[model samples]
Target: MSIQKPGYKSLYLYLSLSMAPLFLAFTPLQPAYAEEIKNGKQVYEIGCAGCHASGVLDAPKFGNNADWLKREQQGFETLVKHALNGFNNMPAKGGNPAYKNEEIIATVAYMLSEAGFPNYADRTGVKAVTTASTPKPAEKPATVAPKSKPATATKSYKNTNQFNRLMAPSSEWNPPQSKDGIHDPENDGTEMLQKPRVAFEPLANSTSGNRVDWVKALHNGEINPRYDRVNPDAMPVVMDLNIVREVKGSMPNVVYPHKQHTEWLDCSNCHPAIFIPQKGANQISMASILLGQKCGVCHGKVAFPVSECRKCHSQAKTAKK
Candidate 1:
């Protein structure tokens, strides 16, 4: 005796098989969603963390619900579009054009999930596409050290060619004087120093180079820095000459404007000392710059860090007709 087939069961079976293609048409297939999130995290750590992690230029802070509230209201797809294109101070794809749309979407999803809104990714209809282009996250080194045997008494050789770790985590960016690694934390005067954010609040904002547009700030009269310490009456001799340096490779040529420098500094600050007065007299390279010579003397030290390539390499290479 065969059991009577239910109408609902028959309808369900029919719909499951017949509508499979239709359902898939609307829904994007994201088989490796977990992998995509992992890749997204890596991408964020490398690039997005620079601004998002710290809320630089009013960017929504990573994992901060308050900062992301308005952004989250716009929906995931809208946020994705903003990231792919450009939003306010943030450049397209976080200023890295090489990043794929898939990676950027995944990154947005990852950020939303951390910001107390995990369902936004699902509401968007299109799941983030995973790509192999995203670099793998580095593995954590072993915390336990190896057991030492009997040690022979000898003079240890110190490595003098060690390089400084220029790339710091977002948490360290513009840290308080007491907490900042550069200052002596134990010193009594350390805590008295004003935080960079508080001091820089009145200054004009910049996307790069210490996050403060010094030249723009000076131009707008937000900051009137003294040209000389001894002579308070001395004024800056602001030259408007622009020196263009031809750079080899795909990078843009360097446009060094004397006007910006002279606005705050004197001629003796660089001429004949840091850079030779005569043209072609001093040989300069990235190696020398990294070693705190030439442009690097002021760049990586007091000005913007050397990592900001576009700050100096502003002149786009003219297309060869």
Candidate 2:
């Protein structure tokens, strides 16, 4: 070798610079990531776990390799941003307003770790912090849901208890007035209507989907049972059907026209499920209706507003001209 004084050489400098990048590459990235994941686990268990754990509404299931992998492909930052701001059918903060940006970030990290990233799952970050899930002594396989029973065909159509509660807000009618005299922000009708949604398409036909106009449409032959599957040609239309309540009843007895509703909807739509065919068989309550239970099912939703009290309270003096 040629004798030379030891000094900074280009080769040595290049190697030194290269080593810097290598060192940085090995630096632990797990600290902050681990912290976020821990926090994320807590937030997710409280707010997100309900739907996400079971994949309700198609929420990404934890440890569901496919759903998590697909979400991961979208980029981790993007996923966090979406959870913070709500995406698609998910309402903002997954419908939990209390979750702050930090809480949401942590929740997202925890979800990702459970999905696939082992570093996030290590739970080795920071000195001391409350963990979302307790560390188990041994890792256990995830519980797989049992297969559902095949539904047997029923004799008549019966609605689930949550029948109309699942409907989108009716655009046709104004939101119900709150006790405070302000427009109630919650549709209080559908959990989905934290914000107003598009109204259901107008019944059969008339000018718009207005119920009054729909009734008029039935009176005229503008629309017909020509379309109804149950009664293709009007079965004996029960006209002037009056439901008279007890004399001491707080509100006037309702005058229901079978001719009108049967005109648009199938009989199974209201039968034993919503309204039992027998009179006085079901207890009708104003509180329940206002809560969108009984008559509130249609009024103020797709048909008309209960505010028009005179419309249904059409017994004797209370009858509208």
Candidate 3:
């Protein structure tokens, strides 16, 4: 016990070791402001990434300084206003009305910060502070569910030079038929007709197409679309089957779910008429579909557009062992 270890501890070292806890206790730690930044990143992925990631509809690419700098030239407040409100081809809050003002601001800040513009959020005087003493989060809005409509594009389809030409933009989606470009505004009866939104709100929602999950809505008893116009009691001959069409190259194989289609349409709508019942009897391709044949007969017109490739081409191709 008398023989000490090889190393010797000085009196100063002992004192410093004893005070280490106090030193750490008095030291300042950064606030949990990263929470806001993380939320911003999440918001971008959920809503903004769809267009921004790929620069669809001329949206600024995520990390592109050139595109972001031009927008940054506009005052920060002005940029915030544009994001909060609709601007050009981009819809407000990237089409999700559910996004909070603070969240949107945070997201824009995150984008700008990541794109080589540091302290952009601070420039606007909005503090991104979070701490243990922070209050409970605000209660969510009563309209928690997404509105049963996609964001109406500001640009008309006729004028848009982008891909996915099927979707047209309108200031007022589901407007009164009289005001709707398709219907004659002079027709008094058109105005009397109920707005499409009013009828659609109750249906299950989707991100694309008419924004109504018509199949799910039917299954959930929200809508009972009559199979026959004259005979209201007529029921569809629902088929629960899937046909997987193998695609060339890296794209996933197409899985055509008959159950979804049959819930609304009869077999006669396709079998023998459009898609021949016999396998390999019918010739199907993207070219033909774009020409309004095969699946295109309904997809681009009534069902979800072909632009949503993952919806149909869902089956992953496995490597040969």
Query: Which runs of model 2 end up more than 4 angstroms from their true locations?
Result: 1-47, 54-75, 81-106, 109-222, 227-238, 246-252, 261-283, 286-311, 314-321
lDDT of 3 by residue, 1-321 (tens): 122222336434544554575555432121111233224666677668878898887888888889899888885556666676667776666665445454556677777876778866442213333321121111211112223322222211122344633333444456667444356555677778888888998999887777787878988999877788899898888789999888866889889898988878778878889988987677676645755788889888988888888999999998632
Q: lDDT tens string, model 2, 36-114?
A: 2235565576567778999987898977878888888887567755775567645555654334344455566677788
Stretches > 4 Å off in candidate 3: 1-171, 230-233
Weakest 10 consecutive residues of candidate 1 by summed lDDT: 149-158
On TM-score, the stronger of 2 and 3 is 3
Misplaced by over 4 Å in model 1 are 1-172, 182-186, 207-209, 230-233, 319-321
lDDT of 3: 0.63
Of the two candidates 1 and 2, the one with more favorable TM-score, higher being better, is: 1
TM-score of candidate 3 on Cα atoms, chains taken together: 0.46
* RMSD over all Cα atoms, model 1: 25.7
Best by TM-score: 3
How many residue pairs clash per model?
0, 4, 0
- Residues 1-321 of candidate 1 have per-residue lDDT tens digits of 112343658646655655576554432222222233234665677668988988887898999999888988886657766776666666656765434445556677778878898874442213322433322211100111111111111100011112432233344457687544346656798888888988888999875666798878889989877778888677888899998888767889899899888887789989989998876676666645765889989888878778888878999989742
